[model samples]
Target chain A: MNKEIGPIEDLIKKLNRLPGIGSKTAQRLAYHIIEMEDVEVADLANSIIRAKKDTKQCSICMNYADSDPCEICSNNSRDDSIICVVESPKDVEAMERSLSFRGKYHVLHGVISPLKGKTAEDVTINQLLKRIENGNVKEVIVATNPTVDGDTTARYIQNILEKYDDLIISRIGYGLPVGGDLEYYDEITISTAIQNRRKLD
Target chain B: MNKEIGPIEDLIKKLNRLPGIGSKTAQRLAYHIIEMEDVEVADLANSIIRAKKDTKQCSICMNYADSDPCEICSNNSRDDSIICVVESPKDVEAMERSLSFRGKYHVLHGVISPLKGKTAEDVTINQLLKRIENGNVKEVIVATNPTVDGDTTARYIQNILEKYDDLIISRIGYGLPVGGDLEYYDEITISTAIQNRRKLD
Candidate 1:
């Protein structure tokens, strides 16, 4: 019953291998690609290839970027003394979107997941340590996700950075987000919110 | 707040242009693509380019294929006297998956959608007429979707083929799909099913 033509089938298979694309979505995308203008298709392909070829990890922060130092690392106006540690480059984008964090970022590339076989050695923790050791960084903020592996990675970083006598290690607050309702939040979040409660200023 | 890097943002915009891929999904896919091995990334890009470059509309049936006539049109064992007309290549694939349609296909590429300004001339209705006129075709199974445009296109085709006394133009049955419950079906589908009820054999 599998009577797909060669090029179409090949495209579908390639698309299906992506992170979130299912077989049905791959099929839809393949057909849409086939129907698109040749110039548009070429542009899409060129962008994919160009992005892969041009992008490199920032040597300092280990974040994916077009240059070695990355824009944030090169910018002197940003607070170089404070570094926000995150699991991926996308997290850096999220933090930047918030517009509140005026510091550099160190991308861990991944969290420490025992079940997934990702360890401290697998991530860019060594690069982060190297940055901290070489720079006059005063504060390190762990902005990894709030999942189990996120907490584990945060604690692991805190343990390793404890030797830095003057450096302040902080984890981003764990609680309901802005505009979130108490009733919609889970018990763990509610408890965490209560535990981290502060007096009115 | 828009401090995204050049190549990364370009890749995200290109990916976001694809159907069903939102900004968030595009970000995730872009990051995933960046993390992928160089060879895998090249393969993915190459496949996209190759699919577009190699594919051509079949001269006979207007279906996208690497070859001129397409596999289905060139297959000698398939019933040439009966043609299955569908709206797109994906629909042809769906019909092929059913394993019941043992005939060649005619891809309309689109249907007559007044809302979308797609008329009979926009689709390959002329190519279909050319196929019917030149061949010893006896039956044409209109397997277009059960949308308003689909019905309009099917009726338009029927009206055009009325001059051919020996031709059997039939619309594919529209009713509850296999494993579909009556309660779950919409009012229109339930009524259509009852209207087209067959004697139990």
Candidate 2:
């Protein structure tokens, strides 16, 4: 009995396609949007278009950027000799949030997920290797996620880069997250934490 | 240490302004949008703008519509004499979903909330009275939510319309939702359900 409103329905369907938005949430959002001021709605629409059109993949790091090299890649303060390789641009952002890494980054775009038919050739693995082959790079940290695909991708990169005797290829440590409770942690995490236990400073 | 990507950050900020989206959810959505195909992102953005530009409020019912009168208002089959008055355009959609109500709707836009400084004069009460003044309407059902403001608004409307001798003003029934367990239901709901109970057929 619900009479269809064409444009609003279209908007709701479009919103429902987003990662976490459900059909109900989409409906709520659509109604909320209709209630919003015209100028505010216009601003939201313009921002979406601007975000899509203005951002480009950084040629050097393969991260989303407004500029070719991106702010991190072009910065002289960051160590060019050390590179932290990650799966995606969002991963680079997460790494940066830790505020400890002063090194440059290489974004692989994706991991080698065989189940999904994503091979090493599918992502920017060659581009990452090309960045490290410049001879100036000494430390190459493989900071991909701890999933099966992440480990496979890291291993593949490590196997190829093994000839570089001076370069240090290290995976980011995997253990219980900081401030995490021991009782709540899974068995693998607890064991890994024990295996990678550090000396008291 | 997370260096701002101009357009992406702006988009995230814009998304965060939405009713239910948190900062983290906004960031995730922004990233997802960036990952989407150019055509898909354009479609999504265009839909937002189109929804805003296309819809107009029905002059008769004050519901959102592509046409001035709205589909429901213009439908000759719908019972105009029995007007179902509710808060907001979304409430009209909710009512339509039930499929039992063939009557037309009148959207009040908001309830009289004294806490929020909204009075009976602030909403579309005058417009509602004007509609009833035409002598065509015989029954007016107040379907505002079961809140303090809802009760106040319903009472206010009922008091004002009492002068119309033939008009029957009624409020929507409040009871336990379908498939809801009685043990989980609040005391007020159980009491209301008992008070409004109908005899077994």
Task: For each candidate in the order shown, give its overall lDDT on alpha carbons.
Answer: 0.86, 0.84
Give the clashing residue pairs of candidate 1, or none: none
Residue-level lDDT of model 2, residues A1-201, one tens digit each, is 675649988999999999999988998899888878889998998898889889888998899988888889899988999887888776676666655578899888888988999998998988877887764898777766767788788888888888877877877666746443323445455445434533211
Clashing pairs in 2: none
User: Cα RMSDs of all predictions?
Assistant: 4.6, 4.7
lDDT of 1 by residue, B1-201 (tens): 766548889999999999999988898898888878889988888888888889889999999988998888999999999998999988888888999989999999999999999999999999999998999999999988898999999999999999999999999999999998899999999999999999998
- Per-model DockQ: 0.75, 0.71
Per-residue lDDT of B141 in model 1:
90
TM-score of candidate 2 to 2 decimals: 0.89
TM-score of chain B of each: 0.96, 0.95
In the range B69-121, model 2's lDDT, one tens digit per residue, is 88889999999999999998778888888897999899998999989999988
